[model samples]
Target: MKNAMPRTLDRLLASFLQCGTWAACALIGAGLFVGTKVLTAGVALFILLPVLRVVLMLAVFARRRDYLYVTIAATVLAVIAAGCVIGIRLGPLAG
Candidate 1:
């Protein structure tokens, strides 16, 4: 079961990325003729992919009762979340 988990997760991650890419392409391509909000939503989805991956890992590690990995993943997730919050609050910076 332990060995099977990684393999399954690997497949799942691959599928997730594939779908995300298609969604992004559709959104951006259509947005080109639509408006800025659609384009922005697509860009946000692309940017969130890595963070979503980390969150996935964190859940898996916690489920496996790997405290060390859980801690590491949680810390990383928190940092990323904080950066996202800060960026949203800061808005566009001037030169």
Candidate 2:
């Protein structure tokens, strides 16, 4: 049971990332022939992958009663959120 959890989590995360990457790539390719909207969607998904992964890890850690990891993941997520908020606020001026 103990060993199974980590294996399951590993498999799940790996599969999720693989599928997400493939989908994003496909969208980007299609967008090349299609339009900017599809390309933007693909780019957004690509950028969001890491955030989604962190969220997944946070959920798993909470489920496993790993408070330490949960806190760490939560902190990382908060930082990401803060950065996003700042970026949005700064807008084009940020660059």
Candidate 3:
């Protein structure tokens, strides 16, 4: 367990780039939900990314039952949520 944080952090950092992957998936899902507009798609994606991340994180934690991993994953999800909120608020105006 002592090495879990470092291992988790490393895994997270590697997949941090995959945030874009989640974002893209989200945008596509959102577009499907709200109709196919660039702004709406962007907004949908912004919201979806964090949700997907949270769901995936929860699943991973559930499977492993690692408290440290869960905490780190939750932190990442929170950061994603903050970014999504800011982006959603600004997205329409930017359009």
- Best TM-score goes to which candidate? 2
Q: Which regions of candidate 3 deviate over 4 angstroms?
A: 1-54, 92-95
Q: What is the lDDT of residue 37 in candidate 1?
A: 93
What are the lDDT scores of the predictions, listed in order?
0.86, 0.95, 0.70
Model 2: residues >4 Å from true position, as ranges? none
Q: Deviation in angstroms for 60 in model 1? A: 2.6
By lDDT, the best candidate is 2
What TM-score, computed on C-alpha atoms, does each candidate reach? 0.77, 0.86, 0.41
Better of 1 and 3 by lDDT: 1
Model 3, 1-95: lDDT tens digits are 74785588458745853875666667767678767795476665655655765667666676677777778878887787798799999999999
lDDT of 1 at 53: 81
How would you order the candidates by TM-score, starting with the best? Answer: 2, 1, 3
Ranking by lDDT: 2, 1, 3
Q: What's the lDDT for residue 62 in model 1?
A: 85
